[model samples]
Target: MHAPSQNREFLGVGWRFPLQVTPNGRIAQARHEQRIEEAIVIILSTAPGERPMLPEFGCGIHNTLFAPNDSRTIALVVHQVRQALTRYEARIDVLDVHAENNLDAPNLLLIRINYRVRETNAIGNLVYPFYIREGR
Candidate 1:
């Protein structure tokens, strides 16, 4: 059997999203599952056309920014999340995507995604807070 670290090699290693520099003056990196999670975040957080070279990249959820807080809008957000992850993150298989309104914050929507790592069959989930309305 391969070592724990070696077994996770298929998940890949990459620079952390938002780009950080370590105290040692080296670029920060994410490995294995952490790298996959961060990739999902980057895919979902970015809007289409936001990247100059990759205009088609990113989730479509940004289009719902002005959409009303209702079942229809929630469904759209779920769809966007699923579509983006399926298209951008090749390391995992998307199992489900759902969204709920934050009780204390009317403008906030909590998006939950359940996924399984394709190579290792490891299951994971992430809850991303999306703001449909800009804070005043």
Candidate 2:
């Protein structure tokens, strides 16, 4: 069943994803901490020019896929991610942003974010997967 949109502003934290209407006829929205988490996903997933009226609203990591993954490049990425989140998401206070390689996942760069929910002061962390492939 599609979840119904409670268009009304909710004071809670977690909710369903995809923000789509289910087969039952309802809109999915994030609620508690999940709401904050999902917002991060949306921000990082969005590429510049993808959102109407918010042309500068994405992490733009995808465009940097081919850059050499050296120390300098990685530092730049961390800065960009931090800047994008700081600019677009007002719900969380970013404490730290780190980029590290996942030994098990050679093709991905894990972006770790430590942040606090501004409303509740609840601290949390999220690891966003950034794909990386060796250029031929």
True-vs-predicted CA distance for residue 82, candidate 2, Å: 0.5
TM-score of each: 0.90, 0.79
Report the C-alpha lDDT of model 2 over 37-129, residue by residue, as the tens digit: 888888889889998898888887867787766576678879988998999888789999999876687667889999987766778899998
Top TM-score hit:
1
lDDT (10s digit) by residue, model 1, range 48-89: 999999999999999999887778999999998998999999
Runs in model 2 deviating more than 4 A are: 1-15, 20-25
lDDT of each: 0.90, 0.78
Q: Count the clashes in each prediction.
A: 0, 11
Model 2 residue 26 distance off true place after TM-score fit, in angstroms: 3.5
